[model samples]
Target: MDSIKVMMDIYKEDRSMKFNIFVILILSLCASLFAGTADDPNLIGWWNFNDGGAKDWSQYGHHGVLRNGARVVYDTERGMVLHNPKAGYLDPNEGHSGHVYCGGERASIADPCTWADIPRSYTVLMWIKSQMWWTPPWPGSPNQFEKEWQAIFTKGTRGYGQLIITTVGTQGRIYFRARGLQPSTNDHINGNTFIDDGNWHHIAAVCEYDAVTGQTALHLYIDGYEEYNSPVIATGSLILCSDPVYIAGSYGGSTKDGEIYMDDVRLYNRALTESEILTAMDEPIPSDFTGDSKIDMDDFRVLAKDWMETDYTIASDTGGMVAHWDFAGAAGETTVPDLVGDNDAVIVGGGQLDGNGAAVLTGGPDGPYIDLGANLGNVISDLEYCTIFIDCVWDGNSTSWQRLFTVAQPGTTEFSTITYVSVNERWLRYYQRHNAHDEETNASNPTYVPEMKGQHQIAISITKDYGLYGCTIIYIDGVKAAFHTNLAPCSLDLLGQTSRNYIGRGPFERDPLDANTINIDNRFAGKINDVRIYGRRLSERDVKDIYEGVSRQLYFKLEAPGNLSDAESTNSKVVDFKDLAALVNKWLQQVPLLEDNLN
Candidate 1:
């Protein structure tokens, strides 16, 4: 029967009135669903060290701060981990710092750093991989790396108890030591396996102490299994000192000359069983594939519908291009054509076409530089938003500024308005100045990776609304690392008086007033792959696709809910005969939900 006819029958037989209010019930799941909800209640401190930071994931926030070059860096294979690079810092507990400091301030009712001091029984666990080598025979101070037994975790600077590494280099094993019985005497335990072979090993030390009898039992676990046990019953309590805790490098101790990576530092209030320890290592399941409760056939149903459908798109926003320099030319050819615009650039000084579609520029003063003509002037003069991408390799000049490309006033002796980009082994500066109003952006990640090595994609985008609401974004490879706004209000103007642009040269140490001087130079020495200038700011998604390459990805979509199988009314009841009839009518039909990916 039709919905209208059913309504008429219901109106005629008005003896029974019904009201059914449908509600959506949502499930509140914690971020640690893979971690097992059973473990969180006992977890005093948990730091996964993913997403490039050491923020405590427990209900109690005991965030750790990075000090002395102790960086939270991302590796393509290892994800995010704490990287403590070699011992070059000045000693007496060192300089060129390499540690994550968890202060002793009581943040929660039972602070993770403080509770160990009042402990009954607990477990300290972490995962570490070493790139350390044996460079013993100390020079001046022991604060410099004199041994491979660098500390991983300790209560105070070598205070109370610690879980450290023993032996040297590739044959290193786990060691746990703490003060016991007397203030001077200490009790210790060691693991059986040598873990310094550049592989991540999960290590845990458990202390079971009986205060009544003053007896303490120490146990060590490696990769979810018990590897060592010591039945040393001591008279004194396990002394947890008053100083703050350090991860990766001990307070006033040594670290690997190479990177010693550590992650997922967790502290538990009680001794966890072998089974619970394994549960803690569970990988998180990505459940938001389609923004639904779980990933099922419904998620892929749209993908199977049509091959021509374009639901997913990762296209480059190359539509509003201002200037593009491919630097394609043969030897003795002075001109490099601007692919987007007709204005071609003239090569000055010693520059050669590498025959591989790239330009290899010679370094220092009197180096090679491509002088871009009026090609970008027309578009950039009226431009409010600008996005630029430079694909280049670093030639390693950390002492002075080395330019990637520069755009400034041509004939003016005094350097005022300019737009410049620089990349060296240690620094990256994306600067824009309009009438001396400067705006600059730097890479936000701990490791300045974009120009530290081989040919990589580095992008800087300036976005603006109608008002002064805008920011500059820095993208390394494809990830947005920084979104910065200039300290003073800025205007985006690349061509102030007349545009004079050059590749592989900077104006920082040039003539006293003029940045376009050839007299003194801070010219770049690297190979230039390509350079792009867009009139409009490119979106983060587009920058990602530009670097990763847009491919055919299936775009799955679904219609609004409550369509049911057949019952086609807003207030249709679930237990109705019409619903069953409608369900049977479309029993074997396929759903048209997903579309194919497009650029």
Candidate 2:
């Protein structure tokens, strides 16, 4: 009977635990929904060089490249030094290892001595694993046994293990050594500890004192806990070694070598308190992203927060995708007029919209000056007022598209008339038949219109300017349409005009007018597809509807697999991550994701 009651109690506790977890999960979901986007600027910093070479440090101090580029260099003695995503990692040689060659004019790949010229009073944190041991003898040192080897080396006089955070000179040293009359020059082995076994340990030291200290004021953290500090008689002048500092080794006069693996080394010029240090050291494994210490949802929260920013390094190994508008279009191809990707679209070139909101559809008879791809028209509905995406040409003829569009001061009140047409049309056949908008030999404003004779991406959004007369906003893509006041039920009339027309060069109504200067040739250039259509007005949630799914896989026109083995094989051919992501986006648009409690 007693056993049964105990089992019942255990089951009750289990249920309670599950209930708590359920509550946490629900709260997390709510928070995620509310915290749609939160930019974290603290993740920004300069990733210094760790090339396993003496000169690599020169990049930061003198020739440092701050971009998110990684370099791996190996040396016979130094083992491996990894400079990736701007952080440094180093592995020791078989038996011996350290940064900076013991005695050499030139540094071999095995010997790297490039210490970053970090600021004074900074925190140094990193993951260290070692199997090298050194403890004071039982009786003591040759004279008196010290406790531990000094872990951090800074500038101070008569090397005393001051243990102060960010030691500057000879007085700065933390280690286990034999107690004795402290040796003056470099012979001072006072209080040095050797715990360099093969076990991985996190070592961090923060030097806040600008000068030497005698009390527990100087702090040192080993695997997150603060170690005892020695009495400060701080009065050394070790030159902070402004040049390349050493790792796993120290060199003031002679050489002190250490065997260990160093990974995730970081330095900050601020002294963290004991609580902060403890929090950092005790942080769960794989939790810290920037290595500044505290870790929680903030790390994972960065993805959506800075979706449009390139502040942190996206882990390519994790299949993380980062898209920035860096790839311009190729020559002789217009791009912006059509949809570029299943996710976001880039609206490249579209003739300017005048202050009066009038855009001459035919670009000065050069040809049809505007083009609204068939698929794109399907995606955009309820167009009233909204921001527009367009690449415009500065046709030295300031009067060209620019004069009336961008030049006018807002109060000009030009109220230029523009037209929005809803046409059930096919592809480019109409324009090609007329030979009007020629892609052959036409160069209007090549500067802004990089692909004048080619392709471009463009979008015209009308939701933003619904109420404002002669106002307009456009985007390359409108998964969810922006809101506009005084919006009308009809899409075209929402533009303040009751117009119904087909997709073709107008006033092709007669002949292509040369004086009109409106030509589709000046429209846009690009392949456009995945145009979505909505009956009612939309919102932000509506836009999210246009695309679904966390991952996208591109479609390929390949032969079918011969058998089940081929289909189920893990080694099956696959597209790259970038293209796959785009494909996933396309699939999301086609079949929206089901947002359920489990997700």
Candidate 3:
């Protein structure tokens, strides 16, 4: 009886062990099916180095040749790594100390490892670690790459058609170079992040040719965050050269005599999305907890519930804003919603929306104007000070009086107006009729007038004192253009008047014959992008910050004075008479008038 009992216990233990093994295998299969996959369709080449040889893991069979003492080694942090130790080639003239050639000797586009194989939109990704810091001996102390650069990877020849990535300076600043189409179209970009602090980092470079803009955009991302992006014109096909793709060093007659480790190099035929890049930064998770393949809300909620069962609120950055009008509403909508306050605007007359989503006016007698209701017009009565800001662009044809903003009392001519007086100049005209008293004041700056032909930012600040009249300061594009003190006393009583407040138009005047007759002759032409009203006077820095926050674009036309190429021969850094003459010539060649009003 004792032997039978012992045999039953042994049988039960073996059965339990087998059941556990089966459960583990099922979970592994589930994880593989649901988690992020490394076999992306756009993947052109992948080298994990786990095979302990210079072999390609992808089915394309683009194997590499490890030369000049480069070897693979096992790493605890990063599995298999290509280790390139210092080979003592300190001179710049000496060739690369050690490197791995992705393509065999005398490789070209016809064979492999060239621009012809890569698509117009492509991405390069890898994990790298620098074991030592070595500054190259170049013209610029730490930045320029005349000869020596610790090359991470490179393709194509030196000048014509090439893409090279290298580390410069002791801080391990990343540098990139590429040339496509014209030789002058060669582009160079650099990163500010330092990765040489003896730590591992994931780096990705995405290059795409934009068909709409006819330009190429290159973006660099480190640790799943975009670090830099720039657009350059690429007019033709990239050059295909017979240079082998070099890893860890370059064959450009310079030696990267520093130890570096690289692992899990990947090349893609298309630019990977930001989420995909983030997934490549880590091992696949067991399940798609977020459902988006990203650690978003769903995953965060699970993590929070497991760690800490507490609720939290995230504060927004838009505090202390009284009234903000972004004007991002739909086209032809009569009502423009205010972002912050209850003061919405009603579009009147022939106001229409533009392609850029700004309200447009045709410089006509009955142009489009926005009317702020009576309730919001009276809100200013509760404050002792106020600031008004507007971003506007004038139509060059508007030489007559144009009112940008106005506050007035209905059934009477009592009002205050901020007007644009002339084409070559701008001034503020203030008038008020209260308690049977008529007062008027104006301010202007002769030396500096608001640029009427381009986009401009206008700001006005007013402060009212109990015993003295208020002070008014007007700013144009963050610069003080006009100021007046002790001119006229502001009345809280006038603000309370149940009159219509208007933007892009002056006071409402009625004809005696018809009470509903409205004169919109003072309506402003062009477009108004953003408007804001603060309950208190803002500092100069605050005004400047608001102006800088608005998006702006500038274009420069380059012309040849004596000879287009010879204009830059005087000094590489300074703009001399030749540059000015070239600019003048370019300006003369084009029509001497503004195009499309304000852009």
Query: What C-alpha lDDT do the candidate models reach, one value each?
Result: 0.55, 0.28, 0.58
Cα RMSD for candidate 2? 26.5
* CA-only RMSD, every prediction: 19.9, 26.5, 23.6
**TM-score preference between candidates 1 and 3, better one:** 3
Best-performing candidate as measured by lDDT: 3
- Supply candidate 3's per-residue lDDT for 316: 26
TM-score of each: 0.39, 0.26, 0.39
TM-score between model 1 and native: 0.39
How do the residues 1-599 of candidate 2 rate in per-residue lDDT, one tens digit apiece? 35334323534666664344334443453344223211211111111223332222211332322112223343111223332221122232212123332121124334442333232345556554443233211111111111122122322212432212221122112342111212332212222122222234455665454544521123455555443232232233322322223333333322233233444444444566777666555543321222322222332333223333332222221111111121134433333232232323333234333323123233332333333333233223223322232322222221222111110012222111221111211111100001111111111222222322222223333222122222122222222111112222222222222121112123222235554444321322122222222222222222222333222111121211111112322223322333223322322332212123214
| Residue pairs in clash, model 3 | 561-582
lDDT tens digits by residue: candidate 3, 184-285: 543656654445534566888777766776666667777666552333445455544566677777766444434688887888778677887877877532
Summing lDDT over every window of 10 consecutive residues in candidate 1, give the lowest-scoring window.
Answer: 18-27
Task: Give the clash total for candidate 1.
Answer: 6
Q: Which scores better on lDDT, 1 or 3?
A: 3
